[model samples]
Target: MHPKRKLTTVIAVGVAPLIAVSLPADTADAHGWVTSPASRQDQCFAGTVACGPIKWEPDAVEGPKGLKNCSGGNAQFADLDDDRKGWQVHDVNASETFTWQLTAQHSTSTWQYFVGNQKVAEFDQGGAQPPQFVKHRVNFGSVRGRQKVLAVWNIADTDNAFYACIDVNVRG
Candidate 1:
């Protein structure tokens, strides 16, 4: 064989496996956000709310710890932190079952919901793997009228959490 051809063949043989091995057969999907009551990101995804990059991946608004804000510490989805935006309001009674859609299921530590400074409900997953969907029944107590509810999903292994803000009109 010609010297150049031989070198080419050797290089191809050496590089082929690396290329194939680098290709992933599947990626572990592990992200989720509240959809019920129409979270801010969910509304953006539905075109009901005009937002930034979060409109594309509504469930992936993750950020570092101590993110009590609606953006989950991400500035790209900061529109969620704005109460002035015309977010769609879902009317509900004192209690409602909130649903979270998970594209990739991950072990969760806890799921919490807040209204202003008050935490109305929480679900402790305790590092257990969650299903495709997670549900929590939230109570508004005596609070009524329109309010922005914040939802936080704390991942068990990560230092980050996913955040969602849902606008709701509570009726007694």
Candidate 2:
């Protein structure tokens, strides 16, 4: 074979596998988000609030399992962590049902709800895969007025969890 042709063939053989390996077999799908009560990212996705990238991918606010912020420690979704961002607060009774719409369901370990550092409610799934829609009726006993609720979905098989922040005016 000609010298240049031999070199070109060798390069092609070496590079093809690398390119193929780099390409994923399936595209990354969105996970889940709190729909009812309208979490910050949910508001962004609904166009109720103008936002950054979270407007396009509300279901992707995923991070280390124990994060407290609405953005799940993701800088791309840093807007979610902004308290002054004019997120609409929904009116709710002391006991309310928070609904999650899952685009891609995962095996869930637990669902946790927090107000400040105080854990308001938790549901254990025991590593079971959840349905497309999940709802948790959380009772905010003695906690009233405007509050930011942090909801987390811990994935059973992963080190990450999906985070959402819901602003609510809890009426007694």
Model 2, position 111, has a per-residue lDDT of 100
Q: How close to the true structure is residue 73 of candidate 2, measured as C-alpha lDDT?
A: 92
Checking candidate 2 for backbone clashes, the offending pairs are none
Model 2 segments beyond 4 Å from truth?
Answer: 1-19
lDDT of 1 by residue, 1-172 (tens): 9999999999999999999999987755648888897888999999997888888888888888556788887777788888888988999989998999999787899998888888888889999999988889998899899888889888899898888889899999
Clashing pairs in 1: 29-104
For candidate 2, the TM-score is 0.89
Q: In candidate 2, residue 15 scores what lDDT? A: 100
Please give, for residues 1-172, the per-residue lDDT of candidate 2 as tens digits.
9999999999999999999999979968899999998999999999998899999899999999999999999999999999998999999999999999999999999999999999999999999999999999999999999999999999999999999999999999
Candidate RMSDs in order: 2.9, 3.0
lDDT score, candidate 1, position 119 = 88
Question: Cα lDDT of all candidates, in order?
Answer: 0.87, 0.96
Number of clashing pairs, model 1? 1
